[model samples]
Target: MFVKSEYQKKLVHVKDVLSMINSGDHVVSGLAGAEPKAILSELHTAADSLRDVSIITCLPMGNYEFFGNPQYKDSFLMEGWFYSGFMRKLHANKNITFIPNHLHFASTKRLDYKVPRIYMGNCSPVDAHGYVSLGLSAVYEKDMIEKADLVILEVNPNVPRTFGDTLLHYSKVDYFVEADYQMPELPVTEPNEKDKLIGKHIAELIEDGSTIQLGIGGIPNAVAQALKTKKNLGIHTEMFTDGMVDLVECGAVNNSMKTIHPEKMIAAFALGSKKLYDFINDNPSVEIKKGTYVNDPYVIGQNHKMVSINTSIEVDLTGQCCSESIGVRQISGTGGQADTAIGAQLSEDGKSFIALYSTAMIKDKTTGEIIEKSKIVPMLTPGAIVSLSRNDVDYVVTEYGAVSLRGTSVRERVKRLISIAHPKFREELQKEADALMIW
Candidate 1:
């Protein structure tokens, strides 16, 4: 048989892919937008025949039956590297657990402990050369694919053909399932007033020719808006979003002045609208490298004037930031925040900024009342995970203003942090600080 014909024999129906599952097998899937829909959506069908099947994923975009149904508890358990709304709402089921790691080592650490039995990744169709592009992400998918005992590619036409370390030969795959499903897209809305002000403050701190790392959020979207006026900015971000597309199209990010990976936009994954997927397709200037290299602090620091812009949920007076959780409950993973923050700080003139609104409007789960709480506090909530340490947080930006705490004492951080807090909470925060002798 010709090579194409030989590889063609691997193509099977989606149900056939499900039959490959075995009891006590561990499975890994691609990140956010690259999540396989048809296969994962029906994995529960095979659960009755299998037991102790653990699935590892990051920011899964779908409410799959395996995750949405509690009946699969004994059959399947999902371990997510990061949590979004889809998995966060299902955390109470007890089948979903969180894995804490920097983006660079998310898969590396896991493999050292347990190598997965299977890897399922979304990919573009095989080309004439029998190569398939690991669309949407190479974050950990590429790594897991190399280690898994069985490799399955869910080939979808909607998947953008991206370049970089994402290409895989057909000979390496055990099976191929032709799946027709819409590619997942993360909705990008316009930033609100508070986010815009925070963006302005962060933009002021970034230099003209700096390389920047940005992730998803209103603040990052706002930062991209405010940065349109900058010149020669380069991207070394973890997620490639529509905001980066805006910057590039507007002539703001030309990648000409980057010290590392100059003239190319490097990211570990792509998660945005169809526009973003279209922009990266067959695009040579953009590279979807694996998370290990893309999010490595040392690699990110090689870029001159590296700036890391991220958002947080809450922060204490000591500059300790909790970006991924609410008290003991895990809200998100400690993805690239710690990675890029420390990496940017390692650069010669790099800066890291953690931006958030001074207060958050939270609906009381018990009383059904809307309560506004200050994000800057004298101390963190009990059991809050410190996603970014005090020593790693260089700049803290709120709508009110920005403060630098790189080498500040606890007392100074307390004062500076309070000064930028929501006005209604300032007096209360100061009183609490005094009572605790935080100063």
Candidate 2:
């Protein structure tokens, strides 16, 4: 079904198109699990050839070594939606730009117009009938091709043929580059001693038949691992990794009680192992959609028993959630954490939880060196973004225990939050709490 057209008939290396890119060109790529490595490799080669080649990406995974060097600073610039391990270095570098947007808007906002001239993406190899799948990032790339001036489709045999908004006709792709490579599998952080204890406590709070929204990280993954025996659990999350696979296989997550989408798992995106990708392939049980719909606080509130469990870098005695930044540094962004937090609060039987360790890294006077410090700051740094306001937060979970903050007095909120603070700093936190007289 390869039509013989000028742009469609070309059998060129992925690098060749990347080499043709010039300044003022906005280049978009499939971020996270579906990154086109071959095209990226070629783009690196053309770093010096192009000027002001603005590359836009979201939740991108894999090595971004080329973007780090100062030599290519003038040639190419990068922007990220969520900071991955590779893009974390960009926060320190001035050349790179950072945009705080939800995952759903990552592709929709750019693809609805001609801002991005070139679209770099990966897809499952054409099937016997010549159809390719968007693999892990269908929600973003589907709209990219519709709007981009040029679409470079990498046909990787290893990309899973996932279902829901994944199918791409051969005629849609402008250039096809044949490549076979394995999708990257990020190793899940093994639950540490603290994580396991926290996980166990969180697991006990989750009841059977509850609709769950979990954030990414070791604690969330551990919490999922601890709930394998709980029955009839439903997932209505913004994103999920390999941890949910085991729960689904073991019949722990049956999606039976969810009022929104019965018997189907709903999410904005998927990022995990090949098995998770393959499991979603052509699977009618999954619906991948935009963040406006998937992460809408109002829409999530429609579901029954919505349990949103998100993390935080720190929490103030006043119950403010700081998830986007660490003190002054912008390490992450306000993702669907607040969206789901509010959703859980609005659900008739729902509960929103901000879970975190209650300490920061600091120096000890006795030891003459820094050690685990308290993250329960008395007050947020001036101008710090309060992602989850006091009205939005319902529960704060720590290894110490869960503190319910909904409808609690300001004084009570401080008392409850400080109660769970690290022992070394509890008295100091209490002293600050008393001085403020936050009641």
Candidate 3:
């Protein structure tokens, strides 16, 4: 192990160390809440002195000067793996580009194209053995740090000391900067009536002792809240959240019956409140593995009775799911929706669910009036990207009801799908289905 004095020798001012970045350098930062705020701020400040500096990021939680200021476009480019609200707002800018990828293969595939010159992220304080934890996110930080030419880290005490593949030796890092900023918190979204209804429908399908995968949002949160009555439920998910913590505390998730990684909650990354951070800090039951292993379908299938519940923007009559986009506009990238959905189906008694509200309020362009429109349309809007294919979907759930599509013909699918659609739209949908000869 490297000595603490040797590691301290490499510590330098954030601005001075970032000044090492040359023009045309490809840089990658720690994603989400794990992003090194101090170092990235310096990079943004130094952008005027550099040109063609491409920064690859995903689910950026903070609004930094680099992304917010249009003047820096000539010097800095933002390439996103997943579009957060900030990235979506910057979509019209020429310097902003979205990279399409599956969450499981995101880091590995990006490195294959072009290895980053710099990999920097925030980490927990160094331990007595000269080891530091990558804090909350281990999604791709470890992979990027291993491939980058220079590795930098910001030491933050607020970051929780998570276990699994998140530990790094001081010797592997080339530079360190002190950062005392608080980790960004994703507040828990209370489940609405519709969300709870949908949750009840999905929860009915989940069996006791089932290992579960949940995405982030009101729907997933509602599902977690609804599952409090379940016994011995386990978690094998991509992103951990506050809701999962509630399950554990409620005595609902003991992980006792999990077929893989028994008695442990396995996840790739986590984002939530300070309460969630405190729960994972040095907790023996939680393991933060890499995305490559955690989100892999084969690994997810190893857990018997796996149930993956993911939200979607819309679904067509054929069961094609459009979760990431609305027509040509990219709202978000394809994360682990397909990964865990397919993986859950591969489990011996697993089930995959796509949940969404039956109706969405949209403003009419011509009339300028807000109207409730059916999300379960006769056909998806033109140019919508299918995040999950028809064959891969097993169950479709709406606040109205839940329908199974597996081994069903197109006619049966159309009828079953229409049954769960908002009642006002069912008549029109049935008429369209009749015209299209779907039934």
Candidate 4:
């Protein structure tokens, strides 16, 4: 009986792996922090020989040559589920496309429509049992790998070995490429005075032992900082970050009262600095699961006192939130905002909060002058996409105050939202509301 080790059999050069990728094959890369840089770079280098190859990804962190140069457009096309700053710039290209989806069903919907031919991602070194962990991100990688015909892994020692639904046996992977690239870091946001005020208002609404779901950015970081004094807070978020790590260290989040996955920080993915990676590496306190379960409204609602804190770019008086876009321009995708907002509201004692600055400084298109305008408007800009409908909003918080919109009439919502607007814009907003006959 001759049985060779799978690792030796699967180990191949980057060019060799690229040679396996046929033209017109659908390729799905890993999500966020788990993206396979080496393999992707090789794919870009070999792009001249391929044609109509589609590269599908979500929130890709680094600036890769493949996406940086537009010359490969004839051979490759890029599709994003959620746009990063780099991807947003690439939107000028006609070949790039965006897929609108809720976070929970992102993988399932794509799979149902078209199963990918190749799945490439980064993973931790093989463990004693020949199992590799999908480190940092498990969002849709698990589902994509299962559906793809060929699975390729970039073995990176720097990637943390996380537990839960991300482990895979060596036999499952068709090829391997060793890589030693530095993991991308998401810096900690310093909360300004306005952010601090908003954080304080949001923190007041959260009681001790509440299960919280927080997205990334300055506002969520501010909220987490505000909750430092609370006790027994549990984390059930879609993306865990450095702020959550701080909460856990401060003894504010003990995960003691969660109805689901009690005593464990439950998340589908993580993106942050090296410290966050070190914290979750082989740490039994953290459990990274699949996005299908982590972001499911039904699953999130099962937790007691679930409080979801998210941010919005602009909000209308009627409670419609434009979080994913600026007017008709797509700044980002609708990533778990609707899911967590509605799910937290579905809980027995849950509350969902949409927080943003009361006003924004925008440059006048005609005059090229920067002007301060109200973000709480009478109506959303024409062509704006509503990430969260009026019916799903529970609490709307600004630096001025926080107002509950749940079960409120249109007139009542207008008044409540107006009270929290920037003092300078209150009068103008009132006049607009009057003209619209909303109050």
lDDT of each candidate versus the true structure? 0.91, 0.77, 0.91, 0.91
Candidate 1 residues 1-439, lDDT tens each?
1287887799887789889889988899889878778889889989889899989989998999897889899999999999979789999998999998999999899999899999987889888888989988989988999999999989898899989989888888899888888888878978999989999999988889999988877889999999999999999999998999999999999999999889999999999898998899999999999999999999999989999998999999989999999999998889999999999999999999999999999988899999999999888889999999998999999999999998999999999999999999999999999999988
Model 4 alpha-carbon drift over 4 Å, by segment: 1-4
Candidate 4 local lDDT, 378-432, one digit each (tens):
9998999999999899999999999999999999999999999999999999999
- Worst 10-residue lDDT window, candidate 2: 2-11
Instruction: Give the lDDT of residue 305 in candidate 4.
Output: 97
Q: What clash pairs does model 2 have?
A: 32-60, 162-281, 162-282, 163-281, 163-282, 359-375, 360-373, 363-370
Model 2 stretches with alpha carbons more than 4 Å out: 1-10, 106-114, 128-130, 363-368, 437-439
Please report, as a residue range, the 10-residue window in candidate 1 with the lowest summed lDDT. 1-10
Model 1 segments more than 4 A misplaced: 363-368
Looking at model 4, the pairs that clash are: none
After superposition, the stretches of candidate 3 with alpha carbons farther than 4 Å from their true spots are none
TM-score: model 2 vs. ground truth: 0.90
Q: What TM-score do all the candidates reach, one by one?
A: 0.98, 0.90, 0.98, 0.98
lDDT tens digits, residue span 353-427, model 3:
999999999999799999999999878889998999999999999999999999999899998999999999999
Per-residue error (Å), model 3, residue 288: 0.7
